[model samples]
Target chain A: MNFQGIFSMSRKDLTTLVIFSIVVLALPIWLQPFGAAYPDLMQKFAIFGILAIGFNILFGLTGYLSFGHAAFLGVGSYTAVWTFKLFSMNPIPALIFAVILSGLFALLIGYVSLRRSGIYFSILTLAFAQMSYNLAYSVLTPITNGETGLQLEAGDPRVLDSMFVAEEAGLPVSNFFGIEMSGIPGFYFCAIFLILGFFITQRIFASPFGMMLRGIKSNQTRMNYTGFNTRPYTLTAFVISGMYAGLAGGLMAVTDPLAGAERMQWTASGEIVLMTILGGVGTLVGPVIGAWLIKYFENIFSSFNESVLHNLFGFLPDGVEGFVVELTSMFVGEGWHLTLGLVFVLVVTFLPGGMMEGYRRITTLFTGGGGDGDKKAKADDTQTQPAE
Target chain B: MDAIFLQFLNGLDKGGAYALIALGLTLVFGTLGVVNFAHGALFMLGAFCAVTLRKILTMQKVVLDEENLTAWGTPTEIRTTYVETWFGDFGTQLVNYSVPLAILLAIPVMLVVGVVMERGLIKHFYRRPHAEQILVTFGLAIVLQEIIKHYFGANPIPQPMPSNLAGAADIGVMMGMDPNIIVYPWWRLVYFAFSVIVIGAVFAFLQFTTFGMVVRAGMADRETVGLIGIDIDKRFTAMFGLAAVVAGVAGVMYTPLLPPDYHLGMDFLVLTFVVVVVGGMGSLPGAVLAGFMLGILQSFASMTEIKAIIPGIDQIIIYLVAVIILLVRPRGLLGRKGVMES
Candidate 1:
């Protein structure tokens, strides 16, 4: 339990990191069998995976639930889109600008929001985020382009556009040097960023800074009593997490080259919270896993209409099949939100550590399940930090 | 000058609704120490109660009118509401007053919903963290909203104002000013009056009644009340129901102003929570005061002169005020020290 050197991963940690990288890199093929290996869905999984990981840095470690994290994502998207609109079609400059701008935005928001803790902190962040969203939709229309969103057009001032070749048909796709950032290439690009994000997140967990954050989460009052200034640490975590969100947003735009104001809505912010909770809050890989699971379900389960249900239950008797499909359809397709809501309630009630805890319980089923008393202690530990 | 007066009137009614919503929110916070994120959902349900009642009262049956002929020379079919068919003129009057009638339906409906919500789900999370309460309630809110959406679809379903009260009231003339200069929508004025009555009644109930006294006492000290041989848990649960009733009635009255949509609850939930926070968490009077203040501020910000001077301020003014208030006075204007901070 010794604090490790900066940038150094222990043997076990390194093994996990490598395994994660391999799995992520091989997702294009591995996920294909699960019927979710399409490039577009893969891209979303990677992009959102990065966003959720960043969110965990603040929420999991510091116990600050930011209901406005979507604002930063929006800020990142707008910045990226503006870069594409004004400068070039290249994603590098757009992404860099996005990260820096959103980092600064988060810095200002965090500085203000971190002035208070608990519900006050949450409300403050929400207020700022809401303001940003409202402005993006209305007054900042010149910058955000209002409801139509910021999209690349046929003729624009792309000063750096001459370096890249335009496509023969339709709008030009975002590129990394000359490689088109669409289809499979886009997934790999996003996957690479996710891996890098995960790696950095792992480092933060092992570092002294991460411990300080954990200390803040466990007891800010005690930390203050012990003479540690918790504000700076928390703010720093907030900024880093914001930048991570910005990077994810940038990646999203890089793949699609569109930025909409709805992306900054409170519901969008709630999605990451749901993702974190569903996977395993504070866990190293839980948020990522959660993100993958949700994105997968949203893509896959939401597509299951009554027809799909009928097809799947075709082997059953006509009356029973019809009845079953009618009932099951309520949990799929447009009813996905209901399913998600039910899952959230159930998970928060029964599995506080989310799906990760469930996984652990099943794995340890033959090993006495750690027994009741020992399991409670472990559960409490995981409750505080779902992932190490 | 008249425009300003009209804006003030506009803000007052809106503020009244905000106050009512915030008052219920603060009630739950005060009594149960749980943030009921689904409070707005209750409000939406209340509004839909009006819609549902109207739909029921106006349920139609088509019959062929042999005396009337269509353009094609076939018998014309006339659709008459069953209420109209059964009760005649009285039923038509009933349909016209469905919004008011919905209050009666919403009272018991909301109480049941609130009790079931508390007993079925929220009861278990009493000992858990505030974060869990928020998450569970938020999820429940979403679920409720989605169910409503499943039944009614996502469109905003407008509830009608009674024909007699649909026009503008010329307050300017009544106040010795130019006629029609300070006119306000009659329904809005009625909403304001209704809100005041509701707010007054709630305060009076808490101020005068024994049940209110017990609830207030429970709010101040839970264990002490329980220690003294009173089952304060049931009282608190009732208080939660009361809060739900308050939110529901507010929503029921507000249907004529803003149409009820699935997302309506969440939309109001954020602003109402802001009002709760800015008023100072768990502070009822503060919630009411902050609600009115923010509502007025929002109206003022939306003024053309104000918007021309500070573009986009209209959209963000309430949130901006929230940010400022939270930073300057984290305990809120009427919030107690070390309430949620501890």
Candidate 2:
């Protein structure tokens, strides 16, 4: 199929895609004021954006909450790193291998886990992920290299690369042809993939399969009674999301060719869930925005210390300034997680649909429910409205 | 033979802890129909209750003595706990028994915490999807643990068991076996015995009391019981408090075995969920049964014989068993019909 045939975007969707691409590509310029322009943090934004967008496919659409998505990510990273070690330092083959291996892993897990729904499915996924993490840290030490993590050794042969060219002096870095996947170039590489991932997610969201997943989420029994077998639909969504996670993991390895078991930890999985919820569950732009917000907080907000807080509160009187700084410091720097927790709770409690709902509410409040406001409201509604 | 016996004892001790935590989890699930991811945080809070009491009991005043300063050519500082300064040996003994005394503090504190959490947060989420409930509670758990970290720092705070019960007891001799074959910590036995009593008391309170009857009825059918004019919501709030206390005391007693840390709750959270699932959701006896069974199985998996065959069985045994059980028997071991099966 041609690109247009695959996506078949409407005018509004095309506008949304164009706007989203511009915002993502211009992140370096836009985020400069916020002190997040550096490539490392920007790469994280793109990478986690991909993760959250993929997660939204299964979670937001199908409402099948998999608490073990991180396992696929870890698998991807391991596969990518192994690809670098055994075959080549080239990123193309590494990412392909990463996505394929993690998809196979997800297929095995999703087949068993999708049999149950709700919290049972959550538990099953959590179990499989934990098992993977445990084995990675112990029994799979030869493959994973245990707690010290898998890193490229200086003398290790890149079999495929060595076949083509003379081996480099030091440990070889991952590259696309000769272009090193690091710094600004690396961020662009990840950003391009993020845009591609977003495009795919957008197409999926607007497709009939997306409608079927939503139908299953609304009422699986009704969908079944309507002569639809929802299992393959859910499983396909699961594998697709898993592949997305794998792609993100592959990107992580491409930028920094080290893979740790920590990426597969349950808490890491929780963080993914938190990002999707913090954005807006079913909305297209929500997860990307959520991932960016969280990555910003994690990188920029966490860098604030007592001295920075003091400077910010320097205008106040001595006693008051000290108290204010102390209070604010607890929510930033080492305590940024506390802020994350607070924000997440507030989002879930007040804005169940997340930041997208908040935006929709603000638009309606200002526009008085007419003209552009009506169209925007209707679009948001179609995305998130509970099925009748 | 001795190794197996010791492993069995270790399993029971571990199982006791598992059962205590799972009992409260299943209790809240049965009563409130809320999936409280913060229940583990309550357990962590209960453990911190002991840490707090110890900190308060050992609050010291420093006195500078000018005459005792030859080494540094400055006044020597002498520190004495306020309790020691006032109550002498009795204060010292109180500090030693801080872990047990924490139960008293945990009961009331956890009760208040549980009630507030249910009324303030979980009550609002009852009508929401189980996913939302899990998300909110998970957020609360992070907040609670972070607050604890802010106050106590991230390191594990060791709570001393009573001085007399500090040493390991030779169980082999008592059981008519060779001496020195099976040595077990005295405190672990105490923990096991205490968990049994607590579990029994919770069961009896529900089985016998009128209040318990109402709560049980509410669990069976909240709307029907509400129609009968019994304030089921209030009782559920109370049951949430009761579950908190059970979890709290379990945490308090567990301090000696594993030092209290901000991350303690999170570590136990996944394992307890597995235990609860294996036992069957909302089944008290099933949770307790599954808790002990998995704990024992985990202990056995950690054995050299088992590890030789399975390698990392000890690390993933509970989750492995949970996956198998959940796939084979979707309702869990003792699950009731039509509860979360859909």
Candidate 3:
């Protein structure tokens, strides 16, 4: 209940937190050897992780399933790009502007959408996202640059103290405080921001506000009866989460300087929701893990071709081998979506607590598994018990 | 006045599509309490049925036509095949004049698919959270679309209308206006008529039939119906299939108006959902009415005058209407008490 209470947590909690932090810190190093290009995948994971974290604050804590979070991400990306075009090429100012812009957009959207809950809310968010996507694709062409996307123009005057000419080939021109910010340096910058985001989220989760949000999630009626204005709390969480999404979007553009209307699409919003759910809703680290897993699959699966399949299936006999390869190929490469869908179905239906629960179960298994099973059974029994 | 009439006609065609798709969505939602994200995919499958039927109808066998040597100076074996090899001779003959025939074919196939989907995938998800239901259905939709795309490439395949109905009808001349003023496509008119028939049939079936009575009872309260010893799940599955058939039939007829593509269902999916919500979540008649109103409003929003006043109004019109409806009547125009809450 107190800040110091969380900070001075039990040894078990402290150890778990420390272990998670170490794993996150070392994840890039562990992932570096699939090729020198693997860090790019890691950077993508971090960016999506940031977005998913923001999304969880609303979805996991408030039980509001938004199907339009991508609009905030798009808004953030666009604002960041615009900031770079008009004010400064520095990432900080662009990120700040993006967060502020996204927060404002989220405030407006959340207010209207939150009026109805459940499927209605989902549909509302989806409609708004679709509208945003359509406008970006056509009506807001001047701002969004239509379908071509927002890109760096060499002719734009930079008001920043630092001078760095736009790069013509390979990557965008970037000089961060007179040091080049291309390739690995750019990725590290994103990584630093992601770490900062995690820290902020960690603080939020351990705060009284987080407790209030959990209360709202559990019973809005009770909170209302207790004389608390539930709307402001929900609205605040929505805006904060929106700002986080904006920050992620800004980072995305900073790492790879382009903002496309597709970023605001309903599908994009769905992807984040999938990430949050896949990672383990209501858990601080679940979304990040889910984001990494999905991004890993996206990048790695797309790169798989016939040769890769053949090599992987080399041990099998000639006739059956070809069939096996064909079947596997159907669910890989271009067929990776099938696998993703199946994973989602399986997780939601069978493992509703998500990957984090699996991890928790494993940990429990190692430390006196017998008592854990009884506890779980009791929990399930309680869940099925009659409500008062 | 002519421009207005033509726009009205266009609105009717578009409204026909919204009504059909929204009707299907509402039926499934009403009976099963599932949001069915894959409804669009089912629509896409229905359109693909036309493409499949056409392919089957066109299969041929080669035959020698030596008598044609009078023109070429040499005898040649002209390749000809029996269309029946693909769809049976009856199907081939019907294909020539067969937009209606395609509708008939699409119905059974789409119905089977709908029933199978409901039984195999959706049945398991009835008690799951809305999010899970959405995710699974969304996955199913993606899988269905990808399978279609894999079988038929990513391009839109245009299906020809029946030859007699191919040309545009000169309605302006009949109305004592300039001949070129307002011409409506015959196929589109036919589609509108077909939609009306289907809509009428569905309403009639629900209103008059004993089976419809049972289904209506189930939709009103599944538990009550179940307690009375009716197999609600089976009936729900039937309703799901019926919804699929409606959507598929709409898609099949819509081929001449818009080419069938893998992504066509997705394009209509969001708009149709909005219509269903606006109509009041489980009300069928409300869905049909909202579909037409939104359709006309959308078309009107696309007008030059409206565009001049506010940009992108056409795209956002339905959503704006939905927001307004929610604000004014959160349960939608005809939503029953306690329906939209869950």
Candidate 4:
């Protein structure tokens, strides 16, 4: 097989890539109207987008619902931060070590966890993650720094940086060569990785390996009976996704420069799952959309105060306005999680394929495209249920 | 010997709570074949029932005293509970035992909640994929916790035990050992006894009653039971309600041991799942056995001597045991063959 030909995308995929790239690159401008254009939130949009994309590869394709991907993310962040402390503050080496280390971590975890399928697999992953979190919070305090988290400290040995440049003042900040990895630069840095991750996911989705993963998802028992060793394929997907989480973690460190044990908590892992399902499982762009949407809701909706609600409902009569504000307040601000939970339930109940399914339904309604809807139904029918 | 005995006692208390929660989870899984991720939320709701009852029982009436003046140069206010005014010492006693009393309130409320949950949401997903079931139930769990948090706020609400059981028990003296060597909290002991009684009642109910027999048969083969002219669905729904009641009472009784926060359910949810898996999925005895075993192991691992050797063994002991058990015996201690093996 020619490697060059294998790497090339079809015209449609190429078009999708180009359009996705443009839209992501223009997020800072377009998001301004929605009040999400700030650097920190934009960086999160890209970072978590990468995280969700990675998560989708495992759960979306292989149907292995991991509750421990956040462990890899935590590993990546810690590795990157340690690199920043020990070596140069350059993101290149930090990212490289982060991905490699997280990949190895994923390999060990996946090898053990993949022995079981269904909910057992999920439990194994969860156990491993919770252990990591607990250990990080207590016994691993020498490395993780306990509840204080790992952060860059001044007067440390920057073995690599010290070779040429003398120590200049305060705490060192992460950078790409000399480019400060903050503000718009950091968002773009994460965006590049997100785009790269998306492209890789798209290629994998189209590849034979991708088909093998999907086959394992559809019917692993049949695959095993047919003399296919599905373990290797599933393990490979797990590692790749773990590396994606690690990369996202590394990006998070680059943008914020802190690694906390909370990053590895099971709830964080659940959030990753939520993003994938909320967007559209098995679709290339769905995870990214889901990540962006959740982050947007978390940041934007949580920021809405009672005064903001009062202003918005000011057009109504005094009593009516007060009631409206009270009702809306429960779903926004501190209660934004309520809205998130409701949306997640509604999505799973109605749109099992998530937003992409909704999009498909809308298009089918307008264009009278019965074929796509039928294909979707067939796919839904074959979905692997968690074994009872 | 004293340390071991103390850890053993501690383990039994912790194990009782674990066993209670795992029993309900396993029951629902066994009867309905549906993994209810919201089981933990039921437990939380139960704990909040106690909190709500305490709030209601202690509702105070403020009266302005015209003859008295405050530092602010205004009339002083006298506060008295309406319960005290109406019923005197009985009301005070009622407020003192609010935690235990919440069990009565939690039973009916949790039954309705469980039935509604089963019929309205869970029934729709019975034929759907397990992944969808987990997702929807997880979402429901989140919604339930969030609603609780909205009313209760983020801080943990403490529930006081009855004044009679407030102090530590001299277990060492009773066992003919050194004084203060094995003192344990009275409430924890009471909790252990309470759980034992509840577990006994549930077992006897299942073993002796016709309803439980049918439910047990349905668990073994739902289609077969249904074909034999029994409405297994209705029984399963009842079983779900019973499971909720068990979890609710466990939470209600546990408030004196640990304060009830909205997030309490989630924290227990992960551990309870591990316990269930370790106990073997769909096995009631396995869940109970594993719960006690893990609880004891955890308490022992937290002993300074053990921690001295293994360093944070206490933090990860249960998970480590779970991992090892799962790896060594895929079906767990008492797991039957072909249950969730696919």
Candidate 5:
């Protein structure tokens, strides 16, 4: 309960907290213009935002680069679904079950993976994640339900339903006590968790513990030489990040109760990595922003087909419109993934510090290009403490 | 006893592919110190080469046959491939063996791709962090796979084995055992033999050639090799090409077994990385040994008897092996200490 000391915040951090709160609260208001007003899209942004933020703690700070984070996410989803199946449709127990199970899973995986550093650690985590996915899709069908996935069935003896009394007509929806965990209410519920996740991550970033992780990232040998045991620090970070992923997964189930084996696939993990790097690795607000942007585009912009493109470019001459549509077709519609890949390449190749660095550079150029001024100092601090 | 023997053979067959992929990965890691996540994409490209070659070879010309008009009042059209027009029966035979013939195109294509990837993108990240290398290469892999997906669509295209080598071969007879009882697929045996030859050739090339020796020297000590005035960079680039060719050929040959899909490369990538790590990073022999060992272990784990005893062991055996090996031997089975530890 005394998390204040862990998340000791400066005045600037408080301002960031206020700003983040405003933006998240404004999502239901201003986001409608951007085509993300719908509850499903809004919930996804919050869910994936949590996923990416959790991923950044280990990758952005410690630089462990576990390719297995999705396994924890998947574990969380399964736990939540099982909780729904057996006992309650309440979000609290489901989330708690999901997070705790995922944390334990992360502990087991991180203990072994952290024993080896650098690429080996990444590969080890990947192997474990893949093994989990393969098992879920095949031999563990009794539990994961194989490719069809584990869904709420009619015969599932949800005992708590009789006690709580089912309110809805057909299938049960996840609830916060009695409040339906769907639609606008669901987005708010997910946002609370995302904000909490962000606050916790911010604290970790500002803590002495976070400083040790930075040391591990910058130079593990130096840390080891200075009488620091790096393994425990790394393992702790991995578990924490894994727990964050679990939290995200739990939130996913809270919003939508289906748990699929594909959720554990390496590509899902890769997307987490992409979100962090694409947004701004090491910058706390960067990954959440990245997750929001990607989900926004994937759900909204990708829906716009050639007709949308034609309408956007209709002001051009008939011949020019045709040419523009043809040229841009490679980056939109069914080609959105191509755009994602290209963005990833360009970001890694040209913008290694990610969009956060780009923002900083532009601000520095505009505000302090003539000299090292207030903007420059602010940018440096932002890089050091990357959270909202 | 016979089941065990069959499992052993199956293990060796699987190991052949694993060893080939791992060897190429370890080679690149040794020579360039780049952890290429795009290696699997290169393998996928190689398999597609066979598909491309067949498509090119069987490009047909349609002609209407007025003399053979149908009852529906339409002329029957005769379709003939360009290759058939040029070389007749020989062209038809070549199409039948397009998988092997793809090697010719795959080697050159893979080499070019490797060179371009290294010269254009990877060279900049040599002094960067391992994370950067991984991120850049991973992005590259995604780009490459997406491009493949864009053109090929998202389905696995099954490739046919050669007509002559389509059925089972009696290896038991050669080994002085009962023939039909211990038969195995001819193509799998061919694949094993092909992998052996390729592996042997790679080792021999490294041992015998001046280029390989210098590359090996560079892998041992890049600064020392550079200070001694050997153009290690060129050799490193060439080694990348060689590694690409190896993976490409492996993929090309494997089309009949796994089928060619845009995603096939990724499915294998995780498993191959495990093999590379378990074998020991930067150690070629270690990669080969671990590949075979894991391959055998995987086959054993997948057995119905084994699964009955230890359910789902088939899915997790490689990871379990990797975890145990890494915890016990931190540097891997044959890896030297402090190679990439920094």
Candidate 6:
């Protein structure tokens, strides 16, 4: 329970962190030849990664599987859009407003929803999210702009002197501290925010507050009986996580400059849940990997066509060439969703700890690690020593 | 008053769907304790069954007549022959004359599908957490919808009602009103009647049959029932199939009300869940009652006056009611003691 000791990074931990940083930094360069605008996609990946990480704090750590987290995302997006519409096109103000608004919305939803746990909690959140989606889709069209989504307009007065001007007819207006909010700049801006989010999360992970959250997750009744009000700790974690989602949502709006009701849909919420579970629920790197994986598949697999398959199998038999193309095409493009679903099932069934755990197992196998074994032995030694 | 009566009937028709869907959901939830999110998709599949069957039954084969000669000296006659060879003319005639026949066909097909799904996927998730169960079923539902969409295309397919029951029925005249003022569709009336029979049959089966008794016992306590040597898993699987059949029949009957489409399942999923929750998690009677009550409430909420007071009340009334019910009585109307105790 020594805070400083826990917070102090070991040499191996520092080395791993540095390696991860280097990998993240070089990801865009590595992905450039793949026809993906690496920085933009990385930005998106990081944003969703942040969202999933926050979600994991509540779900993976606390065992509260909320089905309404996208509502917070939607709230953030809407808030950012509105800030642009009413106040300024400056990304700073817009994002700040988004985070605040989304946080408030999450606080309200979480307070009510947290009243019930387990299945009831899931149903409560699902109902609320659905209600939010429906209202946003139809009745609140004046605000959400209905199915067409809210977009940046030319007529909107740029009240802030530092706001970015639209470069072209269909360009996004973004002016954050005089830095042009065009393509690369925007991506870098989001990346910086993602790093900030990651840092905050890392700090929390090593903090006593984080320990309290883990304690609450492990045994809430015991924590309460041991003279601690657990509500404040849980609420704090929920709010922090909500803010992360809001920040992600704000970045989404900033990048695309549109806020649609579909963003708030239950499916959207479910996707984040999928990302969290797929990546490694409790691990920092897992959600990021999961988000990147899903997004990569969504963007890449969807674009696959007959020609792509033909190119891959040009060496096949002439008569069977068409069949190969047809078969491959079935598992690619629109059919890629089937593959994604299959992966989800397989992961949940076989790798419940997710891709991070897989990575850990590989590492442990290579290193001949006995970290877990040592901990178990130490516990046994302590028990024997006390008996003696 | 006439409008009210018409709305009431509309409510009943809609309530029939709610009852059927909720009944299915409750059956799965009660026996298996798996919140089958895919139930709506199954219902949608059932409606598609009618559409698929209708297409199959009406398929025409082109035959070339070699004996005939045209004016242009071409010995050709391309006559399209209706494939009435398989089923007699009467059977073909029945396909054209009644939509009710589709319901009969859909039930068995849906039952098989339900059984297959239970055996293939849901049976494994009985011991998993609710979240995983929800996610897996949700994934299955999405897979089902995507498959349906892939095969049927994205657009809603309009399945025509039988010729005899295509137009509005003059139910108003029977109730001492102008026939033109409050005309209900004959197919909808038939649907209502069919739902009644289905509900009655389900209730009767549960009330009077030995299998139903055992299933109920299994639902009340699977452990105790299993300890006594009843195959609870088989019974639960059968119950899942029964639930699927109910939902399928509902969808088949509802084809006239709304066209069948892949996304129709998702459109009704949340609302149906609301009905299930409002009815109580594992309470059958509660589900049926809540379905009817919520259905009527929704219809009433869609009234112009109600809309004027609160826009979008129709869409959200059920959820609001669910929240209120959950807040007031966490166990729902007829919820058992420890169903959601975790």
Counting clashing residue pairs in each candidate, in order, gives 2, 0, 7, 0, 1, 1
CAPRI band of model 5? acceptable
Worst 10 residues of 4 chain A by lDDT: A379-388
For residues A1-388, could you state the per-residue lDDT of candidate 3 as single tens digits?
5787647655755665677667666766777675425556767877898899889999888888899999999999999888887767778888999999999999999999888878888899898889899999989999999989999887666566335454354434545765555567776777777777776677677678888999998888899899998888888999999999999999888877789999998878878988988899999899988998899887888778778999998998989889988877767777777677767766765666778977876787688666678767753542321111
C-alpha-based local distance difference test score of model 2: 0.91
Q: For candidate 4, write residues A173-246 as lDDT tens digits.
A: 88888898999999999999989998999999999999999999999999999999999999999999999999
Better of 4 and 6 by lDDT: 4
Q: What would the TM-scores of all predictions be?
A: 0.96, 0.97, 0.92, 0.97, 0.94, 0.91
lDDT of 1 at A110: 97
Prediction RMSDs, each to the true structure: 3.1, 2.9, 4.1, 2.3, 3.6, 5.5
- Native-to-model Cα distance after best TM-score fit, residue B6 in candidate 5, in Å: 1.5
Residues A1-388, candidate 5, lDDT per residue (tens digit)?
A: 3867645688888788779978987898998777669898888888998899889999999888888889999999999999999988989989898989999999998887887888878888998899899889888899888988888877778888767685455788887878999999999999998888888888788888999999998998899999999988888888888988998888888888888989999988888999999889899899988898788777755786899999999999999999999778767777777778778877777777788989979987877566767756765543321111
DockQ sort, best first: 4, 1, 2, 5, 3, 6
Winning model by TM-score: 4
lDDT of 2 at A171: 84
Per-residue CA lDDT of candidate 1, range B52-130, in tens?
8898998999899889999999899988899998999999899999998999999999999988888788777777777
List where candidate 2 sits over 4 angstroms from the true fold: A2-4, A370-388
Give the Cα error of residue B232 in candidate 3, in Å.
Answer: 2.1
| Positional deviation of residue B89's Cα in model 3 after best superposition, in angstroms | 10
Better of 4 and 5 by DockQ: 4
Per-residue alpha-carbon lDDT of candidate 1 for residues A168-244, written as tens digits (9 for 90 to 100): 45677788888999999999988999999999999899888999999999998999999998999999999999999
lDDT of 6 by residue, A51-153 (tens): 9878988887677788889999999999898888777767888899999998998888788777777778888888888889889987999999999998878
- Higher-lDDT candidate of 5 and 6: 5
DockQ by candidate, in order: 0.57, 0.56, 0.41, 0.58, 0.47, 0.33
Candidate 5 chain A, run of 10 with poorest lDDT:
A379-388
State fnat for each of the candidate structures: 0.71, 0.66, 0.42, 0.68, 0.62, 0.32
Docking class of 2: medium
